[model samples]
Target: MKALDYTILTLVIIGAINWGLIGFLQFDLVRVLFGDMSILSRIVYALIGISGLYAISYFGRIGKAME
Candidate 1:
């Protein structure tokens, strides 16, 4: 569970960075690496979305840990 949390967190961070790049520089690292509209790029985007959803539970875990 701990490793899973870390992995999801890392993915979320990567997604955040990608969004930052898109917002500020008009660049998408995933599309650049995988090709525009490629299946691989789509998978990467989906995984990032899933990771973001998983990360929503992080606050609950942290609150429990702090107790």
Candidate 2:
């Protein structure tokens, strides 16, 4: 994978893990790490969300890759 693809995947995985923590342990890792709704935390949240949206493009390539 290219660097951009890898980065996006990494962010998505991190986001998933963060969500898991929130669901299972009632923890907010990003908030704990970067303060509640602080600018840095907000930026991290935005990047994770954008990465998730970009990940949708992967579905389009699945068929092409299988060919």
Candidate 3:
């Protein structure tokens, strides 16, 4: 995969893990690291959202690669 795809996937994975922690343990990695609603945490959230959208495009790429 290309660099952009890799970056997005990494961000998405991180976000997913954070969400899992939050849901299962009542903890948030981003908030703990950056303070609630801090600039850094906000940026991470934005990147996570964008990464999720970018990941959707990879669905087609994977389909093609599998053929």
Q: What are the per-model C-alpha RMSD values against the true structure?
A: 0.8, 1.0, 1.1
Clashing pairs in 3: none
lDDT of 1 by residue, 9-61 (tens): 99999999999999999999998999997999999999999999989898898
Local lDDT at 55 for model 2: 97
Error of 3 at 49 (Å): 0.6
Estimate the lDDT of model 3: 0.94
TM-score, candidate 3, is 0.92
| Residue 26 C-alpha lDDT in model 3 | 99
TM-score of every prediction relative to native: 0.94, 0.96, 0.92
Judge candidate 2 against the unseen true structure and give its global Cα lDDT, from 0 to 1: 0.98
**Residue 42 of model 2: what lDDT?**
100
Specify the highest-TM-score model's number: 2
* Rank list by lDDT: 2, 3, 1
Q: lDDT by residue for model 2 over 25-53, one digit each (tens)?
A: 99999999999999999999999999999
Measure candidate 2: CA RMSD: 1.0
